[model samples]
Target: MTEENRLREKVCLLAKSMFDRGLTGGSTGNMSLRLPDGGLLMTPTGASLGRLDPARLARFDAHGKHIGGDKPTKEHPLHTAFYDTRSTAGAVIHLHSCYSVALSTMSGLDPDNFLPPITPYAIMQLGKVRLLPFFRPGDPAMGEAVRGLAGKRSAVMLANHGPVVAAKDVEAAGNAIEELEATARLTLLTRGMNPRLLTEAQIRDVVTTFNVEWDT
Candidate 1:
């Protein structure tokens, strides 16, 4: 099969995996993969990730035009923002995961670094997750919020919404977002219990070792 067909199948497979595992339910998540030739394949609007038809996935030209298939997600701008700002980003995943969304609703968290240092994996996979203020679902301003980070952050928690992650490929994006949710789950579970977090030195070491995109 051509590389494009392979990628199309990959998107559907990963999306179904996440959906079946309750990462995102109903029709609440969206994902996109950048083709080698600069085109894009995105999950269709209102389509359940658990049952996406590879052939019906939305297609976009390199110029960002929707050329075929069903209509793309209304939050297509969110996916494009990362691709536009981060040259290395090959895939973007946005999910309304439970723990992350719950964490986004809490107060006094660091807006620039929303997730706590509960695990090294979160730091290694996601340098620093930004916490963007709540925007109405599908609002273009959500994309603008991600753009304001200047590509330093690979992930962001949309307040009262969920998490969005950008990575070098479809698998990496999926893994990173899962790490984000796991970290958020840890943060919530350990809240008010004074969980021992990784020290700043350890965090620095992980960042150095992983070449994390840390924005000080």
Candidate 2:
């Protein structure tokens, strides 16, 4: 099969996996990838991740024109912001995962780094998840918020919403967002226990060893 066909099938398969595993419920997530021709392939609006049809996924030309497939997700701006700012962003995933959204609603989160240092993988997969303020769903301002980061962050937690992650590929993006949710779950589980978090020095070491994008 051609690479594009493979990608289409891959997108559907992975999205279905996430949905079946309860990462996101109903029709509350969107995904997109950068096509080799500089175009885009995206999930359609109002479609359940568990039920996406590969051939019906939205297709847009490099110039943002909808050339084929179903209508793109309304959060296209959020995806586009990452692609426009971060040259390395090959795919973007946004999900309304319960744990991450719950974390976003809580108080006293570090805006610059939303996820706590619970695990090294979280730090490596998602360097620093920026916590963005709450915006009404499908608001274009959400994209503006991502753009304001200047491509410094690979992920962001939308207050009262969920998490969005940009990575080098679709699978990497999926893995990173899942890590974000898992870390949030760990944080919530250990909230009152004063669990041992990685020290600043240790975190710095991990960042250095992994060559993470700790700062913009």
Candidate 3:
């Protein structure tokens, strides 16, 4: 298979796995991966991850213009924000996950940092997940919010909406977003129960060891 075909297959398989496992539901969530040629492969708008057709995925040039397959997701600007700001990101995934959305609705979570340090893995894999204010779906303002971060954050929780994550690759994007959702779920499940989260020193150690981006 050609390299593009391999990326198409990889995206479809990973996206379906996320859907089947109930990470993102029907007609929700979107994904994009930068190709070797600086083009992008993206899920179509209004298409469910569980039903993504590899042959029909959207394609965009490095200039962010659509070049093939299907119409790109309406939130294409949001995906492009990461690429425009972050030098390392090669893939972006946005998910309307239940637990993460629920947590975002709560008033107690920090506006600057969404996920509390619950596990070493969250710290190591996610760095610091930002909590961006809500924007109407498809609003270019959402991209602006991410851009304001200046690409310092790889993961962000869209208040009352979902989480968007940009990673080193498509597979990494999937995994990091999963970790965000799982951590949010755990946070809610153990609320008021005094769960044993990683200590400050522990988190600091993980951040240092992983070269994670912890913005104070």
Candidate 4:
């Protein structure tokens, strides 16, 4: 098939995976990817990710006009924010993931680096996931909040909401978001036990070796 068709199918598959895994049940997540031809393929609003039809994906021009397909997700501004701020953002995924949202509200979670170095994989997969304040769903303030990061964070957790992640492509964006959720799960699972985590030096080595965006 063509490139557009491939991306469209990928979008549906990833969205289904998230929904099926309970990451974002119902109609809570939105996904969008920039096409090589300067267009966009996005999931439609009010559609459950678990049931997204590839043929119904919304299509938009490079100028943001709705050219075809179904209505775009209302979280368009949140998606556009990263695309505008991060030049490297080719695809963005926003999910109402459970653990990440719960972790966002917990005390002692550092804003500078939300997830601790429990594992080197988290460090390698997610440079630094920012924790952003909660905004009403579909509020443009979310876009502003993401912009405030100044293109530094690849992922951000919305208080009481879920996480939004951007990456070089749709697959990477989904992978990064999954890593965020997994780390959040680990954090919750080990809370109060004070589990032994990766040392500072080990984390530093991972960051330095992988050229990660650890601002520590």
Candidate 5:
């Protein structure tokens, strides 16, 4: 099979895995893959992740034009913001995972670094996740918020909404967002229990060892 066809199957497979595992429910997530030629294959606007048909995935040219397939998600601007700002981003995933959204609703979390130092994996996979303020669904302002970060953050928790992650590939993006949700779940589980967080020095070691893009 051609690379594009392989990638199309990969996208559907990963989306179904996440959906089946309850990562996102009832058509509440969107994903996109950056083709080698600089075009994009995005999940349709209202399609359920669990039931995607690879042939029907939305397609866009390098210039951001809708070249084929079903209509792209309204959150296309959100995905494009990362591609425009971060030259290395190859895929973007946005999901309304329950744990992350619950964490976003709580106060006292650091907006600049939303995920706590509860696990090295979160840091390794996600780096520092930004907790952005809530915006109405499909708001163009959400893209503006991501743009304001200047490509420093690979992930952001949309306050009271969901989490968005950009990574070097579709699988990596899926893994990183799952880690984000797991870390959020851990944080909520250990709340007020005085869970021992990884120290700053340890965090630095993880960052240095992984060569994490830890933008302050």
Candidate 6:
């Protein structure tokens, strides 16, 4: 099989896996991967993650022109923002996962770091998740918001919406976003219980050991 076909299959499989696990329900998530030829392969708009068609996935040329396949997700700008700013970005995934959205709705959370320091893996997989203020669905401003981060973050939590993550590959992006959701769940679970959190020194150690891009 050719490289694009392989990527198409991989995108569908991973998207379906995420859907089956209830990470993002309905048609609430989107994904994109950088093609080897400097183009992009993206999930079509209005398609459920559980039901992506590899053959029908949207294709874009290196210059961001739609060359073939179905209509691309309206949030392509958001995906491109990562690719434009972060040199290592190979894949981008956005999901309206329950816990992350729930966490975003809560008041008084830090916008700079959405996920509390709950687990080492969250720290390792996700550097610091920025929380963006809510925008109307499909708003271009959302992409601009991500652009303003200047590539310092690999993940972002959309307030009253969901989480968007960009990583070195599809699998890594999926993993990091899942970690974001899990940490949000933990945050809600331990809220008001005053659960002991990793101290500054411990967090520093994790960052140092894992080479985390922590915004210290």
Winner on lDDT (2 vs 3): 2
Candidate 6: residue 102 lDDT (0-100): 92
lDDT of the structure predicted as candidate 1: 0.93
The regions of model 6 sitting more than 4 angstroms off are: none
Better of 4 and 5 by TM-score: 5
Off by over 4 Å in 3: none
Model 2: how far is 162 from its true place, Å?
A: 0.6
Per-residue lDDT of model 5, residues 1-216, tens digit only: 999999999999999999999999998999999999999999999999999999999999989999999999999999999999999899999999999999999979899899999999999999999999989999999999999999999999999999999999999999999999999999999999999999999999999999998856
Clashes of 6: 0
Clashes of 3: 0
Per-residue lDDT tens digits of candidate 2, residues 1-216?
999889999999999999999999999999999999999999999999999999999999989899999999999999999999999999999999999999888889998899999989999999999999999989999999999999999999999998999999999999999999999999999998989999999999999999999967
What TM-scores do the predictions have? 0.98, 0.99, 0.98, 0.96, 0.99, 0.98
Error of 3 at 132 (Å): 1.0
lDDT of each: 0.93, 0.95, 0.92, 0.89, 0.95, 0.93
| lDDT (Cα, 0-100) at 198 in candidate 2 | 97
Give stretches of model 4 more than 4 Å off.
none
lDDT (Cα, tens digit) per residue for candidate 1, span 1-216? 999999999999999999999999999999999999999999999999999999999999989899988999999999999999899899999999999999998888999899999989999998989898999989999998888888888888899989999999999999999999999999999999999999999999999999988854
Which clashing pairs does model 4 show?
Answer: none
Which residue pairs in model 5 clash with each other?
A: none
How accurate locally is residue 96 in candidate 3, as Cα lDDT from 0 to 100? 96
Model 3 has an lDDT value of 0.92
Query: Which residue pairs show backbone clashes in model 1?
Result: none
